[model samples]
Target: MDTTLEELYTQYPDTVKKNRKKHIVIKSEADVACPQIEANTRTIPGIISQRGCAYAGCKGVVVAPIKDMITITHGPVGCGYYSWGTRRNKARADSTTPKDKIYSQLCFTTDMQEPDIVFGGDKKLARMIDEIVAAFHPRGINICSTCPIGLIGDDIGAVAKAATERHGIQVLAYACEGYKGVSQSAGHHIANNTIMQNVIGKGNERKPGKHVINVLGEYNIGGDGWEQERILKDCGYTVNCVMTGDASYEDIKNLHLADLNLVQCHRSINYIAEMMETKYGTPWLKVNFVGVEATNESLRQMAKCFSDPELEKQTEEVIARETARIEPALEQFRKICRGKKAFAFVGGSRSHHYQHLLKDLGMEVVVAGYEFAHRDDYEGRQVIPTIKSDADSKNIPELHLKADEKLYREGNEYLNLSKEQFEALKKEVPLNYYEGMYPDMKNGDIMIDDCNHYELEELIKKLRPDLIFTGVRDKYIAEKMGIPAKQMHSYDYAGPYAGYNGAINFANDVAHTLTTPAWKMIVPPWERIEEPDTGKQEGAN
Candidate 1:
């Protein structure tokens, strides 16, 4: 018999257990009541959380992906050094740009010293920007302040402004310290706000296209954007820019010009979407290209929003042709994967996004959680109006965006829909809203928020899942417990897993992980006998 979640709650102390219970929920199959999980809170004092700090979220995940920008860490060298090349963010150099280089391939840091920390690191940070400009004449430079810089009260914004004036380049500073908020989520907000204030709608160039779109929240981890872009082009849509990932500084500035915005990762880039809509009259369509079926639905949603009969027809042809190509391989994997149970705990949207891909292979995600998702992420965006901001969230500032005087697009510009028609279309498609992950999940499935090590261990024991999709922090722990764990964040060094062909890649990876004979070889310490004082093995080959 599997261990019950109620029994796991007893492992914590009285007050702690009470707090943790709210963060967890086992959906009752026949119950009429909806289960709500408390989210976006600070983790317990002593437990080592799997969540990344604000610095990693801002620098590593968000701004660092811009290939044309020189992202300089405005703190100690270690902060920049350790984080470099950790996220498999990829990009290509476009010769059309001024520098025609991918600066994301390298790491640049202020390399603040002991004296600088005590006195101030701002001067050193300015020098570093000067050096970068002299060496590589890149398009722009983003100064990302780490934990130490924030503590020392270094004015990175001032330094960035001076550098911009002196070097004649776009230099923006991000105060995304690790100590900013409860988790990396705060950093995501900061990065989004910074981009909106300084970058978006600042472009001087425009491309001619009817079906133009800005693919936001796609950081191109493992070339995921390339595959997504290929399919979008096949459906006859001009990709204005893939936000951050494989995207140039010059490219992202024209984000306001897109007829539509296809938002992929809502958690990281939703701020830009909302602000852009307010300023430019562009409606964003929430999209998930992680799975084959979800990708088809997203494309269909895009076609619906545009209301172009010819584009809609072309989209249907692309979907039919691509779905036909991958169906055979999907079936082959389904044979080995059918009825298999999987567990997922990813950073933000991937946990929910990958569930669709797993289902396509005839596998079920029995348990899932997000490392740093808010209540709106678990429940629908309807809950956003009801949610009250805590102190941690209040630390970050909000952007008060208004309609752009010159470039602001009116409602009828691209949509070409009557008031009644647009209202009717929104019912079928998520025009400017996200329904969240709750509706898609099975009734009896588990949802966890900011899951800790102890909870993950208990889930592994109770669920006994065939596979675990998680981050690097918890991957080996699950693997040691004789379960196949795949690092979902970085794709475990494999990918382009975001579209038609990418679906097959995901299925193939799942098939390999499930059938790998190695996980069975792990003999957990708990499973071993009570052999006392000796360091020798009991059953030696």
Candidate 2:
């Protein structure tokens, strides 16, 4: 009795229906490969999409998390105000190199108004940078331009240069206008470029360690980064820096000196990772710490990268210890959560990463989608070259990068692997490859791109999933329809959901949400009556 996807599409106009059909696909057992969904395209005008703007991607996600920098929004107050402390990128001042340099607690803005917009806000941005330098005396300052500044053609880069010279502090600017791309992905790219140009590779101080590594693409959401750091430290690896989460200015500068780079959330930070490899000859590895198995695998991969017998032995021991500690709780939750159905519509990597945890809970992901993921995210990295650039994508600049002759390593000697050894290493560890969401999903599953509310409502009506995983925007809507919804974005403002303990916490949380007694009372007993069916045309007969 459920409406089919075809029937749902009939409601839209011809062009709209045709375009939307490509984005909504059903997996079939007969298919040799996963169905391709059109991604990184503009959202339909009337659809309520969960996608955030490019500025949100850049300033909010990438730049603001650095605890030591004064990130000033170089436009209207609303842009800066809304993004301030929203992501919950937790930082510990006591843990930083210079304990006094923490500034993630404060929100700085140019607060551009009508007058500023009419005649450019560059002067205001420059003055704000000077004030920040004088008052905070922070290690650095990052200025991000909102939509109006881009429209008015304000030169933020010029202002940054002058401010840097005047204050004798590092100043960087990002032209991450809100409308640059289809979503926040563009802003992420811009932020990465700016950071690479200004912040990275400036420090001379070096930390002493044999297996030093940089944790890239982690924003420390709800202490997720902290948990990851704890596990890595336990394995006897020196975590030189986390890309941005709870990161200090000094930690960022010395990233070039790292032996390796471990990338967690690849979509937002892959640009910097790739650039770092090219510039610094620092080899990178893709890592996922979202699930227990994923964390175990990621740790093993890191150990393999080092190819040290002692490190590998320690990693295995740590894995065994952590697994023993959390197995009982995991088993209990799995028993309670078996056969539950789940639907996920979240950000780029989460739609895939959280699948590992859901499977650990014995839940099946019936439907999944990304708000702003491109082909590389949904499909694998192999499709990166095949993907044609559109106007929106083309608007974002790709910086011309050349190797730093002094810093770049000449050969694969850093990897400590010969040609034959490297070939054998792939069998033990996956390097420079990402088999995306498709390979993980099963037949009869659904995959969507840039999923909107209408599609979600329709899918909910048809699938009647037991749990929904998405952002806060759609959480209440799913709950209103009598389903338990867990937020993957902010982790419902509670987590350390990135290791062995985190996996147990996630499984327990899902079990608790699904087994709660409150859902039984959604409709009272009085409303459960079935209406009597009147015999058709009995009087006429």
Candidate 3:
């Protein structure tokens, strides 16, 4: 049987023909080599990649979780503005906590500006920290540097160190430049490493419950982390501290107390997991609460870690109940989404995870590409048995470049293209007019799969896709054009869209976007406005 790529080539010849595999032709060859999928391609030229920079990953995902830690953007105002309350994690605002209530649910940021970025931001960051300390008296302050800071070479670490000594508060400086790598995946790693070095054991560390585990990777989007929190508690384990979701400064410092670290996001938190193992002698395990399969496996794994039969049995019961409740809904989604075609081009981790979930929904991924992925991420895809030629390399970007081939050819970067392979791809994965790079007529349909603002407008006019699955940015455009658009990134505001249960959530999100009432009301500018009366009003006439 032919491999998926081989089948695509055979099914559509010119649009899908094969290209000779790329071998690393050295610069001495003076030849323009075809574009091999480079992990560095995460920062697309002129195109805004959905991937966040290092500062964002650290500040948004890692540092922000510490409810008691004041985070300062230390750059342009747009950075803080864009990130403010953007995460799906839910917390009861301090206002909602009854007057007598003791807990505070607040997320804060030191919004920075142009002057801050242009001049060194150290003074501003220091002042911001001081302001936060004076107002909230936060237990700690985390200063996250943005792109400009890195470019200007502002020493955020030095500032943080000096401030920590003066204020007698924990101050962490994370230098996550946007240009550092392709996606937030890299940012996650950087953040994890910093935490291991700075935040892990800076304060009073009291040993907690023996069964306690440090939850990692889960971002608590849509309160997903809280839901998991409840489930774990029900299972009788003390969730010592969640990595950052609904997490606090005190909680994070005490993370060392937990006997084990339970990580949900393998790509992002695995580094920390490994570090915990080495430093504290605490073992770590990967757990996903996204789907029934992963969720069950995760619970069982946790139980095994404890070697407790009763806890395992209780976990089984919880799974059975949740599975039964969602079974009917999931079956319905399977029926609807079966055989639907999808092309995934999100950042790597989600791209990889989405493959399994989509396959479960009976949908086929016509094309899949990761904006930033390394050699390891491609192992399952690269080794597919049925692949016949190098053209099949598109299935796995790294495979396109033979071992000897250098990735960057001499002249211009954008000029890099594989004529034969691109032609075949044009056919094999015929994008719906809306999805492909250009508007030129092609033999097959196209889905403008991975896109940003500019592509959204152009493609809407040229391709006129039936449905556009994208992030929040393009939702309005697709709607204005009278086409269905689904925000797949954050599960369209509903998710845990990971396993079998996620299938139902995915379908519902798609359907909701497709069938929503707002689409019908959109009208063209010319049609909606009546011409202004030039002839004039009653009295003047």
Candidate 4:
């Protein structure tokens, strides 16, 4: 099919078509890097954008997930409350939860009222930090400023410095205003640079054992961290702290101790991985546990990195065992889900990650896109050098890093290879690499970026896909259209949809969604009493 913008949106008004055409690209080859789709730009005004702000990207997604750090949203109460716990980054705080972690469960905010916003919110923020210390005595407090703080220029950095002195604890202030950039992507870069500068390498502690790796970007959503840890630990890889998810301030401080970093979400946390390489020489491997094939290949690559005979054997053994365990059900689900068309539009990297899982189930993703990913995310890292820094991107600060004297790894110590072998293996492994989401998608498959409500609705009506893989916001819209939509972001509050067993959960759930009988009632009786019945010649009464 010669899929073109005009053909796809023939009925759309010319103004809307002109704006959106560049954002959408029909794939011409499967998984081949294509740079046609425009990405990482500002959304058109008047569109109902699904993109979260920089504040949500930084405070909500990255910084706030630390199990022992108190993240205070330094603006309105609503911003604090709404972003709180919405991610379902389910963390554990035992009955003996420490004082530092107590405030982790609670959402703290300055509640920057009119008076505070007018005069300055800095005083209120400082006061809030004082109150937090007096009550919780937390080890660390991350102040995430909202839009008001940026507009008013309240000097949160000074407040943080003063608070750090007063409380004798770690107080980090982030200028992650909600309106900072094109999308939440700006916040991700902000958070990554901030942590790399202030937090990581601060501790003297070391995580012992061979194959010690930190899993960056795997936020413990629905116990994803637990499941990943389970597999990795079982495989003899000592799982260190994630970038933020379920990690404590103490745990994160020791991040420099890890030999290797395994990155899951490319858009969100890849910045940290890159900076870590620059500063500490800790090589990162791009790994995806969301799909069976991806997990297998990722594990194989990881094993190759550490050329241990036993570890390699162990990785293969685990793969065979796990694949056997899930193959029976996966096969059955594949039979049911075969040839089902899907459209995935979700936050950042999952739009790419979940496509593998869908493919595992024999589903063809007709369309896929990201809410806050850059051009590189869709076109591959080869495009990074070419991507022009727009005004919005330029507004966010980039860090300059150098190797730390004590913590930096001198060579490829993480990879068990001889100097010659290591150099040769670079061609094979290419550590700290991500191929983006393009290569996996076939020609004629549409790739969109920063997708909106109108585009989604129009595409769904036009394509009539079997599955809509999206977040909570648009799930119901698909259901209303009598199509099954899977909540890929939170997995509908039930997932370990990451590795071996999680793949089974995804397959079963997806199969159930498609095969479920309840869908017959989608066009309820109240809405439509009878079908058109074009075949019966209308039984003229």
Candidate 5:
């Protein structure tokens, strides 16, 4: 009987703010933790939670980046098929690259059949690696586990070890079972850890770009990495490597050569960044490349760290030129998008970070949710009263026998579940997902976290948000639905959407989505005419 706020209303309310009072309020002194959701929650015997396991994160985001690596989704074909290049990370294979080398850019999967899952996926994985080697001759392969793999106890690490020895190349295994954490965030950390262990420094290669820096956490989505690279080059610094986005195996092998690391997405890349700093004697800095404030500050801060007066001056110069380039268009977008309301549900740092950028365009984020976030990410944000997991809700539940029909009455404890059940839950859950359950949303606008296609489509159909800012997956759907969906993930093909120049890019991206002619191009299935029967007369003609 768990219900969404929209289900409670007779009709979907115009705004979350309008129907805020109808929802249940958390009682003070409640235990405030729901064992069902506590990463460790043992299936509650019956409550539903929308958290993905660790494997999904590793296979989906981290390991999927290996353009030259053959990845086997070692459980089910569905996971592999759905996750194949789901993001906007463009591959070099599709470009003017040679056909013989196409395997590097193509998404290869074991496409595990049911039989493999029933018995185990070890043999199939090894066979898939063999096939991949014959077809692409890649230097390495990765076997990523899925839900069933975890359940069946597949020792993918051992499998990878055997395969690597047999092939005389690198082979890594990731144990990212989706249920491993509360959200995909845990997967990111685990992914970073695996990279640190196996990929950081092993090969007989070193291109020490003395003036270069490693750009961490900035996935080359929509060429965002390329844009950042241009800016750095303009500032007279070579970008030696990008973390996973557009980063090559060789580039990563030589990553130690960089003088410093500039980390953008702190939540996902912090582990690797810190590891580099500790092991290599390379300093790392937390930087944001989102809005004018963060971008400018990040540049100035990095320049200060470099202790190079000329570099500091170059940073200022780059900012000035880029800022001037987009000022007029930004002003125009401000006029249309200003004062508009927004709500977000994104992975890791993006959910909170984008709020400031949206605000730059004069938009207000009435609601926000994160799929995988740490406590520090939410420390300063206000927590609103709403339905939350036992860990965060702090509410207690009591069974009230009201006229023979026993109903659970609200109590001070946050979790309604019994202790025995929570104790049986898993080892880790992404902390961010649990935190999302408690935000005082005020029901002002629609909010979602780790939303799937169906939920997003439904929300868009009902809410009709003014300018939908989300990743590329949701972008096309929004456009097809006649809703303005901006690619916040890649700045919608116009980037650097961070920094002083980025503010304009943000505005421009939003404006392009909002007023673009493409929104008008959505044609109904019934709109077009059928083909004429001209084929029958081909011989006679």
Candidate 6:
């Protein structure tokens, strides 16, 4: 028999159990409202969490992916060194291109020392920026502060301004300290604010295209961005810019030119999407390209937004072509994978995104959670206003914004339809709607917030899932216990898992991981042998 969540809570001490119970919940059909799980809260000390710090969120996840800019970590060497090339956010640059346009391979750092921390690192930071520009002559420089700089109160913003004036290049600084928030979510917000304040809207040039859109929050991990762009182009739409994945500084500067924005990972980059819409009058839509069904739906939505029949026809044709190509392979995997149980504990958006793929593969997700996601991620954006700001959240800056008088296009043609027309349009494509994760999940399934290693191990023992999807840190741990685990964050260094081809690749990978002969050897052959009457005779003696 399966152990109940209530039964599991009994194992912990009084205080620990009380606190943990709020975070771990099993959905019940009786509850009409969304299940409340304690999220975006600080991890209890002594529990090993998979959450990354705020600096990692800003520098590693967001800023580092811009291929043309040199991202400098303005603190200790370890923070810069460890984050360099850690995430496989692949960027393609031609050697034939100018030297100033490519700098993704380089890891720049101020390398703050004890003395600098004691006084201030402003002078050193300014000198480092000057040296970097003179040496590399890059298009821009992004300075990210670590925990030490935040603690000592280094004036990185002043240094950034000085450097920009001297070098005649775009220089931006992020005050995303590691201790600012509970996790990397805080860092994402900080990065978005900095980019909006500095990089975006500096240029007035608009790339000529009928349907221009920006694919936001896509880091292009494992060529995911490349695949997404390919699909968009095939559907006769112009991909004005990807938020950061394989992105150039020049391309991002003209983001205001795009007519619409398609948000892929809402948790990380929704701030930018909302800000852009308010400032540039570019409407935004939430999109998921992780699974075959999701990709089809997202494409359909894009077509409806443009309200172009020709574009809609092209989108359907591409979907038909791609679906027909992979249908046979997907069926075979589904047949083999039916009735298999899976668990996912990953970063924000992934824990939800992978569910669509898993369901397509005929698997059941028994447990899922997010490491750094807030209540909005689980309960949808509708609850954003109701969530009370705690001390940790209050520290993060909330920028006040106003629409550009010159650029703002109020009641544009695309959105100028009447109430009845808009309703009909929505039937073909959803607009400004996201139902969140809990509503989509099964009633009995477990939904946890900020899941830790101890809870993961305990759940594995009870659930005994056929497979697990999480980060690299938990991969071997699951595999050691005789279950196959796939890294969803980096796709275990294998991907393009964001389009039609990626859906097929993901299905095959899941089947291959589970059915591998190595997993069968976890228990010795002798362990399965029956000793017959010999055990009874020994007991008699």
Winning model by lDDT:
1
Q: Which ten residues in a row have the lowest lDDT in candidate 4?
A: 94-103
Residue pairs that clash (backbone atoms under 3 angstroms), model 6: none
Candidate 3 or 6, higher lDDT? 6
Q: Which regions of candidate 1 deviate over 4 angstroms?
A: 1-3, 29-34, 98-100, 534-541
- Residue-level lDDT of model 1, residues 1-541, one tens digit each, is 2247778888899988899888887766675444677988889899878988899989998999999899998888999999998889888765445445678979998888999989998877887788888988888999898999889898888888899999998999899999998888899999999989888878876667678888999989899999999999999998889988898888888888788888899888888888889988888888999999999999999999878999999999999999999999899999999999988999889989999998888888878899998887778787888878889999999878889888787654658788778888878887888877777788789888888898888888877899999999898889888989999888878997899888998888889989988977888667978767687787976
Candidate 3 lDDT over 303-343, as tens digits, reads 65555667778888887887788778867767766766554
TM-score, model 4 to reference: 0.93
Cα lDDT tens digits, model 5, 1-541, are 1234445433434553232322222222243431111121222212233345576667666667656566677777777777766566654542322335433345566666778778887887788887777767876777777777888887889889988888898888887777666566667767887777788765444444335678888777666666777677788777777767766665677666666678777666766765664565455656667766556766776665555678888999988887777767777888988878665656666766677677667787654545455433443222323324454212111112122122122111112223442233212211111233333233334333344454556555555567666665656666677667665654544665655555766676676666778667876233457768776866675
On the 0 to 100 scale, the lDDT of residue 68 in model 5 is 57
Q: Give the per-residue lDDT of model 2 (tens digit) for 249-331.
A: 88899888888888888889989888987787777888999988888988988898877999999999999999999988899
Q: After superposition, how far is residue 29 of candidate 1 from its true place, in Å?
A: 4.4
Candidate closer to the true structure by lDDT (higher is better), 5 or 6: 6
Candidate-wise lDDT, in order:
0.87, 0.85, 0.56, 0.84, 0.60, 0.85
Q: 2 or 3, which is superior by lDDT?
A: 2
- The TM-score leader among the candidates is 1
Q: After superposing candidate 4 on the true structure, give the runs of residues whose Cα lies further than 4 Å from its correct spot.
A: 1-4, 7-15, 30-33, 93-102, 524-541
Worst 10 residues of 3 by lDDT: 432-441
Give the CA lDDT, 0 to 100, for residue 505 in model 3.
67
Candidates 1 and 5 compared by TM-score, better number: 1
Q: Give per-residue CA lDDT, model 6, range 275-296, as digits (tens).
A: 8877876777889998888889
For candidate 1, give the lDDT of residue 285: 85
- Residues 414-517 of candidate 4 have per-residue lDDT tens digits of 56567777777677886778888888888788888877886777777778899899988888878887888889877877888989888988888999999987
